[model samples]
Target: MGSDCFDESFHGYGEFWCLGDTRPYMRALGAIANLAHRLGDVDKSIAASTEALRLCHGDNMGQRFVLSSLLLKAGRFSDALSFCQVWLDPQYDGLNRPRGGCEFNPPNPELLTARLVEWHSKPWSPGNLLLNAAYAAFGLWGDCELARQYLVLGTRANPNIFVKVLARREKPDGPYSRPRTTNGTDEAHDYRWLTQDLWAEPEAWVWINTNRDVIDIVVKTCAREGCGRREMRPLDFKKCGGCRQAFYCGPECQREDWQAHRQACRQANAPPAPPDSPVYAMSGFLNDEGALDAMTLDNSDDSSDLSDLWEYGVEVEPY
Candidate 1:
């Protein structure tokens, strides 16, 4: 079926699909990706997944989940890490939301929700992405430090899912199966992954809400040597004028930090390099897909937590 699905040579291309109807083509590529993964062809899986992502309505459900998992399974940890981080990026909508020229039903409505359609859409999926990041960190880079950091964030995002993750962390058992969340009040409302059975320990799910710290601790640290104050530092951040990467408590700290920051800063301030990859870019282009044009470019919805308070269903304190 995978081969049949991808056999464009004998495909029946009617005008019905020229406009174009991306549903079948996207599914075919996705199928091919899975087939390649099962065959242990990592590069082929990524290539198929990447091309599938290029289809007009290709941001359908399970796309990123498949791509990320396949990248991990292939032992392409760096690629997997980069892919997961970017997809997890709230600003980039490829995996964050449904976008593309055409509309197709997501593979699992329960796992992946479509926001614009509301009742008709189910954009939220159960996969815990931060866990994948942790894996990409530890498995790929052997960076347990980074893995623990991501784990902290992952656990905070879905503590319910973390219950199982932490349990497995303690056990380190083989054949890691799909772990479900028990936090929700109703058992029927539980969330699970689409590719649970395939990998010994792939990724898991996050449901309902977020519990990540309102502000990241690292992002708030003062740049100056003497004053590395942690929190209550300031709601308002003062960014360096040079690299614009470093933040400080105020102008005084920014000036003070400059001497020490200058040497390392020169390298980053150097001439721009070529685009990293077809799937990654710093600005202007959105890698190759440009899927952000759909659903996200409008900017009607912001990723900030304060934005969550605006939701009608969100439980918030009354003024």
Candidate 2:
């Protein structure tokens, strides 16, 4: 009688079936999450989205994106940032696979290669992910400097993101009938449409407005340890080919800075070490005390410190 009453179509039951996690089941769960969000039950929506992500580990349905936004909406700022870190970047399974796995964050090597996307050279250049990451970082830590870095990268990924969404006073209009282009105005509109309320908080809104200028400010000074010389105009300084983030006045300065920049350059070009990797654990044991912290933008004892000003904290005087 019990067996007869049970619905065979529902895959959420059964010991051997792995909860019937088929594509349809995942989609249905995703829809429920969306509905919950629309209904203003943010916590419930986050739960639903998180479950969907766990069930379909690779996030083939792009549930991670939704989950990320929901996390911020629910005030789970740290979780949102951590989630972005784990999922956004490329994860290489060096021991077993020749290249890397597509299942990225949690490292599911069996996932398809098609699931893998090319990581932009700039770490934060992946549309909403890094943008949310920046917001989450600020929300969690109140560290404007770190948040600014994420903001910069996020803007690079989608140039229209800031102006189209954050800058405007009016909500972006959209039937959203037209297909969205990658990093285009339509994409920005859709993003704004989805997460408009999250950015409206007084503190969050102020942070966005204050830091928005950094995206437009180009720092053309030499990125060497001690020599901070700004060019009169653009193109005077040569950017390092390795990371393309660091600029040098000349080859001599570049050569002098190589020692300081080597580790960071390698990290920028290559996939980051896994969180569980021994590299992170052994860092303290290997390096001198405070050695890692000493690698600053300007470690010089000269006026270079004044020239190599950070975009976030420094104050300016009126003419």
Candidate 3:
């Protein structure tokens, strides 16, 4: 099946599904992504996972987790964070939350928008999601405060995340094979194992090491250079409409800080360039029925923490 079939089925049934089920197509794409990732084809894996997410609007197969991992691995920091935001605040972003049985809607636009959605930036609880978001913020944007908030949230959701992430270990090259549980050690280990190389980089490791002891996540200070006021809740601080990272005590602080923060703000909020060409072609492998069937069959045991969170019966608290 291709885009034509995906579109026909998507519009015909109001949801692209197979035999009253949505997993087969999504699973096939995910399997393709996993196979590509295992073979070190990051770009192909990202594209495949991205297509998987588009097909399964409800993310029944947890394609977002795979996409996020690949984006970060490829060092597409801005893209990773931007992709993660689609699920952060569906209402604010005009995103259709398909979990409520809504009509199918693709998560990202073909022509990516630069409009920032900051009214509700709190991410749903999952150590890996928080960790990925944190890495994206810190990577090229160099926004340590935003990264710190994510790290704090990840630590709160799963206490063992930082320890395992910062530990020295051989990074696993394939998709995580174990069942994941919400806020469990398994979830932490899975994230740590898959993303070990990202953290192993000197810059990322130093940042994690430097901020490892920061647990007082309750209060955040104004972004203005001289303003020392801090607020426990984000509602009390006004966020910069451009970057959505800077928080101000009031308009006075924001106005005063504009000149100093303009360049970074623009850079942070700019729409990313289109994805680079895939490093390798896998059409032959995908077309091989036997290979596709085998890969999909083996994916039955592969579950992501975000996908399994609800099934694990845990209430996700906002940080």
Top candidate when judged by TM-score against the true structure: 3
Q: lDDT per prediction?
A: 0.42, 0.54, 0.55
lDDT of 3 by residue, 1-319 (tens): 3356556344523244432455566567778987888788999988787676555454545566667768899988777776665555445343333431222233232222233222223222555766777787777457456666665565555544554454443455554454444445555555665577787889877776666343234234888888998764323554666555576777777777777877777776566433342212111111212122111101111233222111210121111
* Residue-level error in angstroms, candidate 1, position 48: 1.6
Tens-digit per-residue lDDT, 1-319, candidate 1? 3344333343532111223445566557767876776676878977877666544233542356556656566666676666655555445554333222112222111221244123211223223555566656666544345555554554444333433222222222221122212121111112123223222343322311121331342125776788977534223444454444465677667556666777665655455454453222312212123232111111111122131121211122212
Q: After superposing candidate 3, which stretches have Cα over 4 Å from the reference?
A: 1-4, 12-14, 17-22, 90-124, 212-319
Candidates 2 and 3 compared: the better one by TM-score is: 3
CA lDDT, candidate 3, residue 235:
35
lDDT, model 2, position 132? 83
Model 2, which residues run further than 4 Å from truth? 1-21, 92-124, 172-179, 212-319
**What overall lDDT, based on C-alpha atoms, would model 1 receive against the true structure?**
0.42
**Candidate 2, clashing residue pairs?**
none
* Cα error of candidate 1 at position 47, Å: 2.3
